[model samples]
Target: MPIYEAIYRSNDHEELITVNSIEQHEKFVDVKNHLYCTYQGCTARLSYVPKGKVRAHFKTWPKNNHIQDCTDYFERMVTANKQKSIATSTMALSDKHIKSVLDNLKRKRKEQESGTDKVKTNRKKKPRPKVNPDSFENTTLNIVPTTGPEADLTSGENNIKEPSVRNRSLINLSDDDLNWTRSVECYIQNVETDDNRAVLELRDGNYTFRVFFEEFFFDNAPINFRGYFEDLKYLVQRHKEYLFSGVGLIEKRNEQYCMLVNRGNDFRIDDQYIAIFLQNASA
Candidate 1:
Protein backbone atom coordinates (compact mmCIF):
# COMPACT_ATOMS: atom_id res chain seq x y z
CA MET A 1 0.00 0.00 0.00
CA PRO A 2 1.19 3.52 -0.89
CA ILE A 3 0.49 5.23 2.42
CA TYR A 4 0.28 9.03 2.28
CA GLU A 5 -0.21 9.86 5.97
CA ALA A 6 1.23 8.20 9.06
CA ILE A 7 0.87 8.18 12.84
CA TYR A 8 3.80 9.69 14.70
CA ARG A 9 4.02 8.53 18.30
CA SER A 10 6.35 9.63 21.06
CA ASN A 11 6.47 9.25 24.83
CA ASP A 12 4.63 12.53 25.37
CA HIS A 13 2.52 12.99 22.26
CA GLU A 14 0.81 11.22 19.36
CA GLU A 15 -0.27 12.91 16.16
CA LEU A 16 -1.17 12.30 12.54
CA ILE A 17 1.35 13.48 9.96
CA THR A 18 1.22 13.64 6.21
CA VAL A 19 4.08 13.14 3.79
CA ASN A 20 3.86 16.74 2.64
CA SER A 21 3.86 18.03 6.19
CA ILE A 22 6.79 15.83 7.07
CA GLU A 23 8.72 17.35 4.20
CA GLN A 24 7.73 20.87 5.18
CA HIS A 25 9.08 20.32 8.69
CA GLU A 26 11.76 17.79 7.95
CA LYS A 27 14.43 19.25 10.20
CA PHE A 28 12.14 19.70 13.23
CA VAL A 29 10.75 16.13 13.19
CA ASP A 30 12.08 13.49 15.54
CA VAL A 31 13.36 10.48 13.62
CA LYS A 32 13.42 8.30 16.77
CA ASN A 33 9.67 8.52 17.25
CA HIS A 34 7.65 5.55 16.05
CA LEU A 35 5.99 5.99 12.64
CA TYR A 36 3.00 3.80 11.85
CA CYS A 37 0.13 3.54 9.39
CA THR A 38 -2.35 6.40 9.82
CA TYR A 39 -5.38 4.14 9.88
CA GLN A 40 -6.61 3.14 13.32
CA GLY A 41 -5.67 -0.39 14.47
CA CYS A 42 -3.07 -0.70 11.75
CA THR A 43 0.48 -1.35 12.93
CA ALA A 44 2.20 -1.29 9.55
CA ARG A 45 5.27 0.92 9.57
CA LEU A 46 5.29 3.65 6.96
CA SER A 47 8.72 4.64 5.69
CA TYR A 48 9.01 8.13 4.25
CA VAL A 49 10.09 8.44 0.65
CA PRO A 50 11.36 11.97 0.16
CA LYS A 51 10.48 14.00 -2.87
CA GLY A 52 12.57 13.46 -5.95
CA LYS A 53 11.20 13.19 -9.47
CA VAL A 54 8.00 11.98 -7.81
CA ARG A 55 6.28 13.68 -4.90
CA ALA A 56 7.09 12.61 -1.35
CA HIS A 57 5.03 9.67 0.00
CA PHE A 58 4.94 6.94 2.64
CA LYS A 59 5.74 3.38 1.67
CA THR A 60 5.00 0.10 3.44
CA TRP A 61 7.58 -2.65 3.77
CA PRO A 62 7.19 -6.27 2.78
CA LYS A 63 6.36 -7.18 6.39
CA ASN A 64 3.60 -4.57 6.73
CA ASN A 65 0.94 -5.05 9.45
CA HIS A 66 -2.38 -3.49 8.43
CA ILE A 67 -5.88 -4.17 9.66
CA GLN A 68 -8.16 -5.77 7.06
CA ASP A 69 -10.43 -2.71 6.88
CA CYS A 70 -7.78 0.00 6.59
CA THR A 71 -7.92 2.09 3.43
CA ASP A 72 -4.30 1.21 2.72
CA TYR A 73 -5.33 -2.40 3.29
CA PHE A 74 -7.88 -2.04 0.50
CA GLU A 75 -5.18 -1.18 -2.09
CA ARG A 76 -4.89 -4.85 -2.91
CA MET A 77 -8.66 -5.11 -3.11
CA VAL A 78 -8.67 -2.23 -5.56
CA THR A 79 -6.15 -4.11 -7.64
CA ALA A 80 -8.34 -7.20 -7.60
CA ASN A 81 -11.40 -5.25 -8.68
CA LYS A 82 -9.42 -3.46 -11.38
CA GLN A 83 -8.12 -6.75 -12.69
CA LYS A 84 -11.58 -8.28 -12.72
CA SER A 85 -13.01 -5.34 -14.61
CA ILE A 86 -10.15 -5.39 -17.11
CA ALA A 87 -9.87 -9.13 -17.58
CA THR A 88 -12.69 -11.02 -15.94
CA SER A 89 -12.20 -14.00 -18.21
CA THR A 90 -8.65 -14.66 -16.97
CA MET A 91 -9.38 -14.36 -13.24
CA ALA A 92 -9.22 -17.61 -11.30
CA LEU A 93 -10.78 -16.66 -7.96
CA SER A 94 -14.50 -16.05 -7.61
CA ASP A 95 -15.79 -12.49 -7.04
CA LYS A 96 -18.36 -13.71 -4.53
CA HIS A 97 -15.63 -15.10 -2.26
CA ILE A 98 -13.73 -11.80 -2.21
CA LYS A 99 -16.90 -9.80 -1.53
CA SER A 100 -17.92 -12.10 1.31
CA VAL A 101 -14.52 -11.79 2.99
CA LEU A 102 -14.64 -7.99 2.78
CA ASP A 103 -18.19 -7.85 4.12
CA ASN A 104 -17.35 -10.09 7.09
CA LEU A 105 -14.29 -8.06 7.99
CA LYS A 106 -16.20 -4.76 7.74
CA ARG A 107 -18.97 -6.18 9.96
CA LYS A 108 -16.47 -7.44 12.52
CA ARG A 109 -14.77 -4.04 12.63
CA LYS A 110 -18.13 -2.31 13.06
CA GLU A 111 -19.08 -4.65 15.90
CA GLN A 112 -15.84 -3.93 17.73
CA GLU A 113 -16.28 -0.17 17.31
CA SER A 114 -19.86 -0.37 18.63
CA GLY A 115 -18.75 -2.37 21.71
CA THR A 116 -20.89 -5.28 20.60
CA ASP A 117 -18.02 -7.75 20.33
CA LYS A 118 -17.20 -8.84 23.87
CA VAL A 119 -14.55 -11.37 22.96
CA LYS A 120 -12.26 -8.66 21.59
CA THR A 121 -10.29 -6.26 23.78
CA ASN A 122 -7.26 -4.08 23.49
CA ARG A 123 -4.20 -6.37 23.42
CA LYS A 124 -0.47 -5.77 23.15
CA LYS A 125 0.77 -5.72 19.60
CA LYS A 126 3.08 -8.53 18.58
CA PRO A 127 6.74 -7.60 18.19
CA ARG A 128 8.05 -7.53 14.65
CA PRO A 129 10.57 -10.25 13.76
CA LYS A 130 14.20 -9.18 13.64
CA VAL A 131 15.98 -10.17 10.44
CA ASN A 132 19.65 -11.11 10.54
CA PRO A 133 21.44 -10.36 7.31
CA ASP A 134 24.36 -12.72 8.04
CA SER A 135 22.12 -15.82 8.21
CA PHE A 136 21.36 -16.00 4.46
CA GLU A 137 24.95 -15.48 3.32
CA ASN A 138 25.85 -19.14 2.77
CA THR A 139 22.41 -20.71 2.48
CA THR A 140 22.00 -23.45 -0.12
CA LEU A 141 18.76 -23.52 -2.09
CA ASN A 142 16.66 -26.64 -1.52
CA ILE A 143 13.49 -27.52 -3.43
CA VAL A 144 11.37 -30.40 -2.18
CA PRO A 145 9.30 -32.22 -4.76
CA THR A 146 5.67 -33.12 -4.11
CA THR A 147 4.77 -36.71 -3.22
CA GLY A 148 3.81 -38.37 -6.51
CA PRO A 149 5.53 -39.83 -9.55
CA GLU A 150 9.05 -38.42 -9.79
CA ALA A 151 8.87 -35.36 -12.06
CA ASP A 152 10.35 -36.21 -15.42
CA LEU A 153 12.86 -33.54 -16.51
CA THR A 154 12.52 -34.25 -20.15
CA SER A 155 14.64 -32.19 -22.58
CA GLY A 156 12.62 -30.16 -25.05
CA GLU A 157 11.05 -26.76 -25.69
CA ASN A 158 7.90 -27.92 -23.87
CA ASN A 159 8.96 -29.63 -20.67
CA ILE A 160 5.51 -29.80 -19.03
CA LYS A 161 3.71 -33.13 -18.85
CA GLU A 162 -0.09 -33.16 -18.85
CA PRO A 163 -1.39 -33.71 -15.34
CA SER A 164 -3.98 -36.44 -14.88
CA VAL A 165 -5.89 -34.18 -12.49
CA ARG A 166 -7.47 -30.84 -13.30
CA ASN A 167 -6.06 -29.13 -10.22
CA ARG A 168 -2.35 -29.87 -10.30
CA SER A 169 1.03 -28.33 -9.63
CA LEU A 170 1.91 -25.23 -11.66
CA ILE A 171 4.75 -26.93 -13.54
CA ASN A 172 2.50 -29.90 -14.31
CA LEU A 173 -0.11 -27.75 -16.03
CA SER A 174 -0.06 -27.67 -19.81
CA ASP A 175 -0.73 -24.61 -21.97
CA ASP A 176 -4.40 -25.51 -22.37
CA ASP A 177 -5.00 -26.05 -18.62
CA LEU A 178 -3.74 -22.68 -17.31
CA ASN A 179 -7.19 -21.11 -17.15
CA TRP A 180 -8.48 -23.33 -14.32
CA THR A 181 -9.02 -21.59 -10.97
CA ARG A 182 -7.14 -23.29 -8.11
CA SER A 183 -4.27 -22.88 -5.65
CA VAL A 184 -1.21 -24.72 -6.97
CA GLU A 185 2.27 -24.92 -5.52
CA CYS A 186 5.53 -24.49 -7.38
CA TYR A 187 9.22 -24.51 -6.47
CA ILE A 188 11.24 -21.28 -6.73
CA GLN A 189 13.89 -22.32 -9.20
CA ASN A 190 15.66 -19.11 -10.15
CA VAL A 191 15.52 -15.34 -10.74
CA GLU A 192 17.21 -14.11 -13.87
CA THR A 193 17.91 -10.69 -15.33
CA ASP A 194 16.65 -10.24 -18.88
CA ASP A 195 17.69 -6.90 -20.33
CA ASN A 196 15.63 -4.28 -18.44
CA ARG A 197 13.18 -6.92 -17.21
CA ALA A 198 13.18 -9.53 -14.44
CA VAL A 199 12.20 -13.16 -14.88
CA LEU A 200 11.12 -15.48 -12.08
CA GLU A 201 11.21 -19.20 -12.75
CA LEU A 202 8.98 -21.65 -10.87
CA ARG A 203 9.42 -25.38 -11.16
CA ASP A 204 7.32 -28.42 -10.28
CA GLY A 205 8.66 -31.85 -11.12
CA ASN A 206 10.69 -31.38 -14.31
CA TYR A 207 8.86 -28.47 -15.92
CA THR A 208 9.69 -24.82 -15.26
CA PHE A 209 7.31 -21.86 -15.69
CA ARG A 210 8.56 -18.35 -16.20
CA VAL A 211 6.98 -15.07 -15.05
CA PHE A 212 8.39 -11.98 -16.73
CA PHE A 213 8.35 -8.62 -14.98
CA GLU A 214 8.47 -6.40 -18.01
CA GLU A 215 6.64 -3.27 -19.12
CA PHE A 216 3.21 -4.92 -19.01
CA PHE A 217 4.00 -6.25 -15.55
CA PHE A 218 4.90 -2.79 -14.22
CA ASP A 219 1.76 -1.28 -15.73
CA ASN A 220 -0.39 -3.46 -13.47
CA ALA A 221 1.88 -3.42 -10.41
CA PRO A 222 0.62 -1.51 -7.36
CA ILE A 223 3.93 -0.36 -5.90
CA ASN A 224 7.11 1.19 -7.18
CA PHE A 225 8.37 -1.25 -9.79
CA ARG A 226 12.09 -0.66 -9.39
CA GLY A 227 12.05 -0.77 -5.59
CA TYR A 228 9.65 -3.71 -5.39
CA PHE A 229 11.64 -5.63 -7.99
CA GLU A 230 14.78 -5.12 -5.94
CA ASP A 231 12.94 -6.31 -2.84
CA LEU A 232 11.76 -9.41 -4.71
CA LYS A 233 15.30 -10.18 -5.81
CA TYR A 234 16.57 -9.80 -2.28
CA LEU A 235 13.69 -11.93 -0.97
CA VAL A 236 14.21 -14.80 -3.41
CA GLN A 237 17.98 -14.76 -2.97
CA ARG A 238 17.74 -14.88 0.82
CA HIS A 239 14.88 -17.38 1.17
CA LYS A 240 15.01 -20.97 -0.06
CA GLU A 241 11.31 -21.80 0.22
CA TYR A 242 8.19 -19.72 -0.42
CA LEU A 243 4.75 -20.03 -2.02
CA PHE A 244 3.24 -17.69 -4.64
CA SER A 245 -0.53 -17.52 -5.03
CA GLY A 246 -2.15 -15.24 -7.62
CA VAL A 247 -4.57 -14.87 -10.52
CA GLY A 248 -3.25 -14.38 -14.07
CA LEU A 249 -3.36 -15.75 -17.53
CA ILE A 250 -0.91 -18.38 -18.75
CA GLU A 251 0.49 -17.79 -22.21
CA LYS A 252 2.47 -20.22 -24.33
CA ARG A 253 5.26 -18.79 -26.40
CA ASN A 254 7.72 -20.88 -28.39
CA GLU A 255 6.43 -24.00 -26.60
CA GLN A 256 7.17 -22.50 -23.16
CA TYR A 257 4.57 -21.37 -20.62
CA CYS A 258 4.73 -17.89 -19.11
CA MET A 259 2.53 -16.62 -16.30
CA LEU A 260 1.28 -13.02 -16.36
CA VAL A 261 1.05 -11.57 -12.85
CA ASN A 262 -1.28 -8.74 -13.80
CA ARG A 263 -2.67 -7.63 -10.43
CA GLY A 264 -1.39 -6.69 -6.97
CA ASN A 265 -3.77 -9.00 -5.08
CA ASP A 266 -3.56 -11.66 -7.74
CA PHE A 267 -0.62 -13.26 -5.94
CA ARG A 268 0.88 -13.79 -2.51
CA ILE A 269 4.38 -14.94 -1.69
CA ASP A 270 4.36 -17.40 1.27
CA ASP A 271 0.67 -16.75 1.85
CA GLN A 272 1.65 -13.26 3.00
CA TYR A 273 -0.77 -10.32 3.16
CA ILE A 274 1.23 -8.66 0.41
CA ALA A 275 2.93 -10.07 -2.68
CA ILE A 276 6.53 -9.87 -1.39
CA PHE A 277 8.01 -12.79 0.57
CA LEU A 278 8.06 -11.57 4.22
CA GLN A 279 6.51 -14.36 6.33
CA ASN A 280 9.05 -16.80 7.76
CA ALA A 281 11.63 -15.78 5.16
CA SER A 282 14.04 -14.53 7.77
CA ALA A 283 13.51 -17.54 9.96
Candidate 2:
Protein backbone atom coordinates (compact mmCIF):
# COMPACT_ATOMS: atom_id res chain seq x y z
CA MET A 1 0.00 0.00 0.00
CA PRO A 2 1.31 3.46 -0.90
CA ILE A 3 0.99 5.85 2.05
CA TYR A 4 0.55 9.55 1.32
CA GLU A 5 1.07 12.07 4.13
CA ALA A 6 -0.49 14.95 2.21
CA ILE A 7 -2.96 15.46 -0.65
CA TYR A 8 -4.75 18.24 -2.48
CA ARG A 9 -8.50 18.59 -1.98
CA SER A 10 -9.23 20.69 -5.04
CA ASN A 11 -7.56 21.44 -8.39
CA ASP A 12 -7.48 25.19 -7.81
CA HIS A 13 -5.85 24.96 -4.36
CA GLU A 14 -2.05 25.36 -4.21
CA GLU A 15 -1.15 24.53 -0.62
CA LEU A 16 -1.10 21.11 1.05
CA ILE A 17 -2.85 20.84 4.41
CA THR A 18 -1.56 17.98 6.49
CA VAL A 19 -3.63 15.73 8.74
CA ASN A 20 -1.60 17.17 11.63
CA SER A 21 -3.53 20.40 11.12
CA ILE A 22 -6.15 18.89 13.42
CA GLU A 23 -5.70 17.51 16.91
CA GLN A 24 -5.04 13.84 17.47
CA HIS A 25 -8.17 11.74 16.69
CA GLU A 26 -9.97 14.94 15.65
CA LYS A 27 -8.99 14.70 11.95
CA PHE A 28 -12.04 12.56 11.05
CA VAL A 29 -14.34 14.67 13.20
CA ASP A 30 -13.09 17.90 11.65
CA VAL A 31 -12.44 17.19 7.93
CA LYS A 32 -13.49 13.64 7.03
CA ASN A 33 -16.36 14.91 4.93
CA HIS A 34 -14.15 17.41 3.09
CA LEU A 35 -11.14 15.23 2.25
CA TYR A 36 -10.54 14.01 -1.32
CA CYS A 37 -7.52 12.90 -3.36
CA THR A 38 -6.37 15.57 -5.81
CA TYR A 39 -5.62 13.09 -8.59
CA GLN A 40 -8.02 13.38 -11.51
CA GLY A 41 -10.63 10.58 -11.87
CA CYS A 42 -9.65 9.08 -8.50
CA THR A 43 -12.32 9.10 -5.80
CA ALA A 44 -10.20 7.69 -3.00
CA ARG A 45 -11.05 8.81 0.52
CA LEU A 46 -7.92 9.73 2.48
CA SER A 47 -7.71 8.20 5.96
CA TYR A 48 -6.02 10.31 8.60
CA VAL A 49 -3.68 8.62 11.06
CA PRO A 50 -3.46 10.68 14.22
CA LYS A 51 -0.32 11.45 16.23
CA GLY A 52 1.35 8.87 18.57
CA LYS A 53 0.26 6.04 16.25
CA VAL A 54 3.30 5.44 14.04
CA ARG A 55 3.43 9.20 13.47
CA ALA A 56 0.57 11.31 12.09
CA HIS A 57 -0.06 10.97 8.36
CA PHE A 58 -2.69 10.41 5.67
CA LYS A 59 -3.19 7.15 3.83
CA THR A 60 -5.44 5.98 1.00
CA TRP A 61 -8.56 4.12 2.09
CA PRO A 62 -8.04 0.35 1.96
CA LYS A 63 -11.05 -0.27 -0.29
CA ASN A 64 -10.57 2.64 -2.69
CA ASN A 65 -11.12 1.03 -6.10
CA HIS A 66 -10.56 4.24 -8.06
CA ILE A 67 -7.02 4.71 -6.67
CA GLN A 68 -5.69 1.40 -8.04
CA ASP A 69 -4.52 3.14 -11.26
CA CYS A 70 -4.03 6.70 -9.97
CA THR A 71 -0.80 8.74 -9.92
CA ASP A 72 0.32 7.31 -6.58
CA TYR A 73 -0.32 3.81 -7.88
CA PHE A 74 1.79 4.54 -10.98
CA GLU A 75 4.61 5.89 -8.75
CA ARG A 76 4.63 2.65 -6.77
CA MET A 77 4.76 0.64 -9.97
CA VAL A 78 7.71 2.72 -11.25
CA THR A 79 9.57 2.28 -7.96
CA ALA A 80 9.04 -1.50 -8.07
CA ASN A 81 10.35 -1.57 -11.65
CA LYS A 82 13.49 0.34 -10.63
CA GLN A 83 14.10 -2.08 -7.75
CA LYS A 84 13.80 -5.04 -10.12
CA SER A 85 16.26 -3.44 -12.54
CA ILE A 86 18.80 -2.88 -9.74
CA ALA A 87 18.45 -6.44 -8.51
CA THR A 88 19.19 -7.94 -11.95
CA SER A 89 22.63 -6.90 -13.21
CA THR A 90 22.84 -9.13 -16.25
CA MET A 91 20.44 -8.41 -19.13
CA ALA A 92 20.63 -9.84 -22.70
CA LEU A 93 20.93 -7.10 -25.37
CA SER A 94 21.13 -7.40 -29.15
CA ASP A 95 23.84 -5.60 -31.18
CA LYS A 96 21.23 -3.34 -32.83
CA HIS A 97 19.78 -2.39 -29.43
CA ILE A 98 23.25 -1.50 -28.08
CA LYS A 99 23.92 0.70 -31.11
CA SER A 100 20.55 2.50 -30.64
CA VAL A 101 21.32 3.19 -26.96
CA LEU A 102 24.76 4.67 -27.79
CA ASP A 103 23.21 6.90 -30.48
CA ASN A 104 20.58 8.18 -28.02
CA LEU A 105 23.29 9.07 -25.49
CA LYS A 106 25.24 11.00 -28.14
CA ARG A 107 22.10 12.86 -29.25
CA LYS A 108 21.27 13.82 -25.66
CA ARG A 109 24.82 15.11 -25.04
CA LYS A 110 24.65 17.28 -28.17
CA GLU A 111 21.26 18.72 -27.16
CA GLN A 112 22.54 19.52 -23.63
CA GLU A 113 25.65 21.29 -24.99
CA SER A 114 23.59 23.30 -27.48
CA GLY A 115 21.19 24.36 -24.73
CA THR A 116 24.11 25.47 -22.52
CA ASP A 117 25.62 27.48 -25.36
CA LYS A 118 22.30 29.22 -26.05
CA VAL A 119 21.91 30.15 -22.39
CA LYS A 120 25.46 31.55 -22.25
CA THR A 121 24.91 33.60 -25.41
CA ASN A 122 21.62 35.07 -24.22
CA ARG A 123 22.79 35.97 -20.66
CA LYS A 124 23.51 39.66 -19.96
CA LYS A 125 25.75 41.04 -17.19
CA LYS A 126 24.56 44.08 -15.26
CA PRO A 127 27.17 46.73 -14.32
CA ARG A 128 27.71 47.59 -10.67
CA PRO A 129 26.75 51.13 -9.61
CA LYS A 130 29.50 53.38 -8.28
CA VAL A 131 29.10 54.66 -4.72
CA ASN A 132 30.00 58.14 -3.49
CA PRO A 133 31.83 57.98 -0.15
CA ASP A 134 31.03 61.60 0.68
CA SER A 135 27.28 60.98 0.82
CA PHE A 136 27.62 58.79 3.96
CA GLU A 137 30.30 60.84 5.76
CA ASN A 138 27.99 62.98 7.90
CA THR A 139 24.91 60.75 8.03
CA THR A 140 23.53 60.33 11.54
CA LEU A 141 22.49 56.72 12.11
CA ASN A 142 19.36 56.68 14.26
CA ILE A 143 18.76 53.77 16.66
CA VAL A 144 15.09 53.19 17.34
CA PRO A 145 14.28 51.23 20.51
CA THR A 146 11.50 48.63 20.51
CA THR A 147 8.71 49.06 23.05
CA GLY A 148 5.66 47.16 24.38
CA PRO A 149 5.55 43.44 25.33
CA GLU A 150 7.93 42.25 22.62
CA ALA A 151 10.65 44.63 23.77
CA ASP A 152 11.50 42.70 26.90
CA LEU A 153 15.01 41.51 27.82
CA THR A 154 16.20 38.81 25.43
CA SER A 155 18.01 35.63 26.41
CA GLY A 156 21.84 35.31 26.56
CA GLU A 157 22.21 39.04 27.13
CA ASN A 158 21.11 41.53 29.72
CA ASN A 159 20.34 45.27 29.37
CA ILE A 160 20.16 45.18 25.53
CA LYS A 161 16.77 46.49 24.35
CA GLU A 162 14.87 45.12 21.36
CA PRO A 163 13.55 47.51 18.70
CA SER A 164 9.84 48.50 18.85
CA VAL A 165 9.11 50.10 15.47
CA ARG A 166 6.70 47.94 13.40
CA ASN A 167 7.34 48.88 9.76
CA ARG A 168 10.41 46.65 9.30
CA SER A 169 9.09 44.30 6.61
CA LEU A 170 11.42 43.94 3.60
CA ILE A 171 8.62 45.02 1.25
CA ASN A 172 8.26 48.29 3.11
CA LEU A 173 11.92 49.21 2.72
CA SER A 174 12.90 51.39 -0.28
CA ASP A 175 16.00 52.26 -2.27
CA ASP A 176 16.11 55.68 -0.62
CA ASP A 177 16.90 53.91 2.67
CA LEU A 178 20.16 52.51 1.28
CA ASN A 179 23.18 53.01 3.56
CA TRP A 180 20.83 54.09 6.33
CA THR A 181 20.88 51.92 9.43
CA ARG A 182 17.60 50.33 10.59
CA SER A 183 16.63 47.63 13.09
CA VAL A 184 14.69 44.61 11.85
CA GLU A 185 13.62 41.53 13.79
CA CYS A 186 13.20 38.59 11.47
CA TYR A 187 12.93 34.80 11.72
CA ILE A 188 15.98 33.01 10.34
CA GLN A 189 14.78 30.67 7.60
CA ASN A 190 18.10 29.70 6.05
CA VAL A 191 21.81 29.96 6.74
CA GLU A 192 24.76 29.47 4.39
CA THR A 193 28.43 29.77 5.31
CA ASP A 194 31.45 29.93 2.97
CA ASP A 195 35.12 30.69 3.26
CA ASN A 196 34.67 34.44 3.04
CA ARG A 197 31.06 35.08 4.04
CA ALA A 198 27.89 33.86 5.75
CA VAL A 199 24.38 34.55 4.43
CA LEU A 200 21.10 34.28 6.30
CA GLU A 201 17.68 34.33 4.66
CA LEU A 202 15.18 35.90 7.05
CA ARG A 203 11.43 36.19 6.80
CA ASP A 204 8.81 38.34 8.52
CA GLY A 205 5.55 37.05 7.10
CA ASN A 206 5.58 37.25 3.29
CA TYR A 207 8.52 39.68 3.27
CA THR A 208 12.06 38.28 3.14
CA PHE A 209 15.50 39.85 3.59
CA ARG A 210 19.00 38.44 3.26
CA VAL A 211 21.63 39.16 5.91
CA PHE A 212 25.24 39.15 4.75
CA PHE A 213 28.19 38.57 7.12
CA GLU A 214 31.76 39.05 5.97
CA GLU A 215 34.52 36.72 7.14
CA PHE A 216 36.41 39.70 8.54
CA PHE A 217 33.77 40.26 11.22
CA PHE A 218 34.03 36.76 12.59
CA ASP A 219 37.82 36.61 12.36
CA ASN A 220 38.28 39.96 14.05
CA ALA A 221 35.51 39.70 16.65
CA PRO A 222 36.45 39.42 20.33
CA ILE A 223 36.49 35.87 21.70
CA ASN A 224 33.48 36.48 23.94
CA PHE A 225 31.33 37.82 21.09
CA ARG A 226 32.58 35.28 18.51
CA GLY A 227 30.52 32.42 19.97
CA TYR A 228 27.28 34.25 19.22
CA PHE A 229 27.69 33.68 15.48
CA GLU A 230 28.23 29.94 15.93
CA ASP A 231 25.23 29.72 18.26
CA LEU A 232 23.12 31.62 15.76
CA LYS A 233 24.16 29.28 12.94
CA TYR A 234 23.25 26.24 15.03
CA LEU A 235 19.83 27.65 15.97
CA VAL A 236 18.94 28.58 12.40
CA GLN A 237 20.05 25.19 11.06
CA ARG A 238 17.88 23.43 13.63
CA HIS A 239 14.87 25.56 12.67
CA LYS A 240 14.59 26.93 16.21
CA GLU A 241 12.62 30.10 16.82
CA TYR A 242 14.62 33.24 17.51
CA LEU A 243 14.54 36.97 16.90
CA PHE A 244 17.47 38.52 14.98
CA SER A 245 18.46 42.15 15.54
CA GLY A 246 21.03 44.15 13.63
CA VAL A 247 21.74 47.51 12.04
CA GLY A 248 20.87 46.72 8.43
CA LEU A 249 21.79 48.53 5.21
CA ILE A 250 18.85 48.00 2.85
CA GLU A 251 19.73 47.26 -0.77
CA LYS A 252 17.25 46.72 -3.59
CA ARG A 253 18.14 44.00 -6.07
CA ASN A 254 15.57 43.12 -8.73
CA GLU A 255 12.93 45.03 -6.76
CA GLN A 256 13.53 42.88 -3.63
CA TYR A 257 15.11 44.19 -0.45
CA CYS A 258 18.26 42.64 1.04
CA MET A 259 20.15 43.81 4.10
CA LEU A 260 23.92 43.95 4.42
CA VAL A 261 25.53 43.77 7.90
CA ASN A 262 29.20 44.45 8.39
CA ARG A 263 31.65 44.54 11.30
CA GLY A 264 30.78 46.89 14.27
CA ASN A 265 27.04 46.60 13.59
CA ASP A 266 24.68 45.70 16.44
CA PHE A 267 23.80 42.12 15.43
CA ARG A 268 22.02 40.16 18.15
CA ILE A 269 20.11 36.87 18.31
CA ASP A 270 17.72 35.95 21.14
CA ASP A 271 15.58 32.86 21.37
CA GLN A 272 13.71 34.05 24.46
CA TYR A 273 12.36 37.09 22.63
CA ILE A 274 8.66 36.34 22.33
CA ALA A 275 7.51 39.49 20.64
CA ILE A 276 6.03 38.81 17.23
CA PHE A 277 7.59 41.35 14.83
CA LEU A 278 5.26 40.25 12.03
CA GLN A 279 2.15 40.94 14.07
CA ASN A 280 3.38 44.44 14.83
CA ALA A 281 4.08 45.05 11.15
CA SER A 282 0.53 44.07 10.26
CA ALA A 283 -0.93 46.19 13.04
Encode model 2's per-residue lDDT on 99-199: one tens digit a residue.
34334434444666688422222235453444453433333222332211132233212333222222244434555466444445566887777656677
Listed in order, each prediction's TM-score against the native is 0.38, 0.34
User: What overall lDDT goes with each candidate model?
Assistant: 0.51, 0.48
Per residue, candidate 1 scores C-alpha lDDT tens digits across 1-283 of 3567777877777778886676444432363136788777778777665543245577775466578897877332222222221211111233333333334444544776798854433356554444453443333222221111222322121433222112234423554454333334455667766434766778755567776556655555554655655666777787746554444456676677776554455455655534335434445
Supply the global lDDT for candidate 2.
Answer: 0.48
Worst 10 residues of 2 by lDDT: 83-92
